[model samples]
Target: MPATILIVDDNELNLRLATRVLEKDGYQTTTALNGFEALELCDQNPPDLAILDVMMPDMDGYELCRRMRENPKLKHTPIIILTALSSVDDRLQAFDVGADDFLSKPFVPAELLARVKVFLRHLEVRAVGNENQMARKIAVFSLRGGVGVSTLATNLAAGMSQLWGDETALVDMAFFNGQSALMFDLPMRNTWGDLAQIPEEEIDAEVLNQVMLRHSSGTRVLAAPRSAVNADQISEEKVSHVFELLQEQYPYIIYDLPHDFSATTLVALDSADKILLLIAPELASVRAAGMALTVFEELGYPDEKVELVLNWNFQSQGLPRGEIEAALKRKLSIVIPYVADSIVTAITMGKPPILSMPETPLGALFEDLAFRWSAPEQKKKRPESPTDAWRRIAERMRKRAKAASS
Candidate 1:
């Protein structure tokens, strides 16, 4: 049976257009001229998803959405607000009313269908109740700057989103000067600055959603503030609360941490499930990693929880991997081969290799890293509705299992 959609709009022409387009695409669509009729229809038979227009005379979409959320029978159904009001305020209102998505009016059919597909697919998965995997929180760090910490963090977050088609968040904890948003080519519409002054008690899912910037690749970014002064306004407690909220909502959370071990940095590092402590193939980076390891030990963080990654940022001669491992007293868990030209181009183009070139060496490396460190439960069970990315994961798992047995 096809998924049913309820499209509520006051304009008959708009209703017919949406209904025809959706039905033509093999979805079962029902239409209503106002929110009252839509509510009556929902009571009779709730839709899998609701596409509501905002300007209904009987009751606006925002009110209808709030009422629908309060309805026990229709609470879990995803609601998407479609309106000509494309302003940020309108979108924020929709989110406040419990909308799962928002689309501006005069939307393309393909874009509408794509959003519907993702919404339905997520609904189907939730209906199965197979998602027991807890969110994995990862902190990508380096005591030394320019060791590709942010680069790796960005790719890992984006890669995980692409792989599972689930929500992933990249949190830029480098409050002073973070570039997670720039790497994704996202405008500084909303960032951590929004939450810096908000009372800690008021910081919840809704507030966090308002601050997070969504990327085109399905990843969300909690960006650093644009101004350096705003960084101080954000407290360590606020950082902790934000991470707590993110951990509950996102399936994967990657923190792009700053170089120093400040109070805020310590808070994030403490909450992390795994720490990717990156080091370059240079003496300075090696010494920094060693110091970081010593601090991790002092903080009682286990050796297994930290993965020391060797990033070859430059092709010039530097300390050997063996010597670095000996000095740190731990074997390197992963190595990122130098691809200076490609990496530079990726940065300049504002497309991470994971999104722009997943088949490339750097891209595959990040994908493999994401797979290796994901929650163990996710690795054990296959999702009910598998995407192309999921299929690739399954194939990779099979190969790894076979190799291990052999």
Candidate 2:
């Protein structure tokens, strides 16, 4: 059966237009001219999603949304607020009232359809999560700084979102001045600091969702606190609890870890399904990588649990692959060539290469890596509806296999 949608607007023309657009897309839509009628309709039969116009006769969209959130039957329904008010305060008010998304009035039909598709897709994925499909967690770590840990983590998260067409979590574990949010050019509206004062038991999925920064690419970021002092308030227990909740919701969780063995870092590392140990070709980076491997061994991590990633951060005079492998006693699973200009441009623009330059070499490399690190179940079977990123990666794999055979 098609998913049911409830559209509430004071204007009959607006209601009919929205209803027609949605019905054309095979969605079953019910329209109401006011919030009271909408409530009555909702009480009789709830909808999977709702689109509300801000201006209404008896009760505005804000009030209706708040009331729906309080209603047990409709609390979890995804709400999108449509209004002519495009001010920042209006958008904030919509979100404050528990609206999932906001769109300015006179919206393009295509944009409206796109937003609806994304929310419905998310709802379907959440249902799958309830069936015990735990997310695949990947932690990107390096003992030394500036080895492109954040770079890789951000790109990996973005790539996963594009490949799977679902939201991927990019967690900034670097409490002090982490740049995950900045890399995505998202504002620091909310962060882990928001949950610092809340009791661990009180931090549920709803709370986590409010605190996360949602990127346009569908990669949600749990950013580091804006103030460094807030970092001290986040305990290891809180980190562990948050990770547990995140694993239940997201399909992929990527951690951008800071350079240290702090308790909080340990919690994330412990929870990870796979660890990407990144190392640059320099001597200090190599030494740091060795130390990290020893620590992993001490922790009794299986050999296959940790994968070595050799990153060429610099252009020249780097150690040879043979010698680096010999020194570490582990083969590098992936190697990233130096692309200084591209990296600099990406940082300046606050867009990951995977999303910005996906057809380029660097972008394609990260896309392939994301597919490789995807859950085994996802890799075993083809997606029912393959995304563009999936199709591109599949084509590349086919071409490579053909070349080898020939």
Candidate 3:
């Protein structure tokens, strides 16, 4: 399909000339004699890019650009000021009103065509970079090593994507020896290692996208560097910037954080909407969870934002749940029973059980957890076009509720 370009000019001759030039270059043109007509047309069908004449009756291009930027539906559409005023001050003012580019009125036909193609290309790129606005950020952290942190994080991120059919970003905040990418069997084609050398200021949504490794399960993994030396090159500022960027595009951003309270880990914890603190059924793990809870209190994070999950990392007997809860002074929210062989096989194959075995008991548990931790919009009444995954989850939930009532 040809790119749609909205041309707004009060002068009929200029409108016809601009429209003809763009249409000749295989662009679909919509001509508007005034700003009001342009806005009305935009409301009806927003264009891919807009070309506006600065000099207009009642509303100038600057004002019209501002209005368009304020409209959520058309806010991201590229705006170019096509005007006779070629002064620096006029160009700056046009940009101040959110105009992407300012072209002089007496533009060379080739130059005009070139600018249109460039802006339309930019519009398409922006559309690709701007994904779903995921409002929640969940971080899975453990104060002790080998506590199933990565396993939980990977499954939660993948399961949320499966349950809600929304974008989920899994970040390896471990920086060193992170297995987030390996858990999904994704090759490290792009990882945080690539962004380590880039300036923090240069990183944004597009830059992040360049380094993310997409999985078949609709989860995007920002893996840590395979080498510790490369991992050390990544700055805390860069990790912070990546988190800010991910929050805008993914509904659920899950962090497989390192065990220590390093600068990078602290940034993820601070920005997390919910922290799933994982602890195993062991003395050392219980003690670590207690210490973590103390730190959370010191950080002034609300109790509700933190959930304790007990995973039976070992098959043998260990600390009981009651004693662990008493030690931490917080109730355990969820517990994962020992499924050692299955978990090991899944991890070795780089397929989380949530995606590989959705019909199994372990798979159902993770799906339920994903649904419970999802954003409010996902939990709202069934959408018009529901997926099989959503239907199965809804039916299972209804059955569970009925069982409880009985």
Q: Estimate each model's TM-score.
A: 0.73, 0.79, 0.69
Scanning candidate 1 in windows of ten residues, the lowest lDDT window is 122-131
Q: In model 3, which regions exceed 4 Å deviation?
A: 1-134
Q: Highest TM-score, which number?
A: 2
Q: Which tens-of-lDDT digit does each residue in 8-97 have in candidate 3?
A: 999999888888888888899998998999999999999988999999989999999999988988765767888888887997788678
Q: What lDDT is obtained when candidate 3 is compared to the true structure?
A: 0.84
Q: Decide which is better by TM-score, 1 or 3.
A: 1
Can you give the lDDT of residue 143 in candidate 2? 98
Question: In terms of lDDT, which candidate is stronger, 1 or 3?
Answer: 1
lDDT tens digits, residue span 240-349, model 2: 89999898888899999999999999998888999999999999999999999999999998999999999999999999999999999999999999999998899888
Error of 2 at 150 (Å): 1.0
Sorting all predicted structures by lDDT, with the top scorer first, yields: 2, 1, 3
- What lDDT is reached at residue 380 by model 2? 87
lDDT, model 3, position 241:
79
Pairs of residues clashing in candidate 3: 134-251
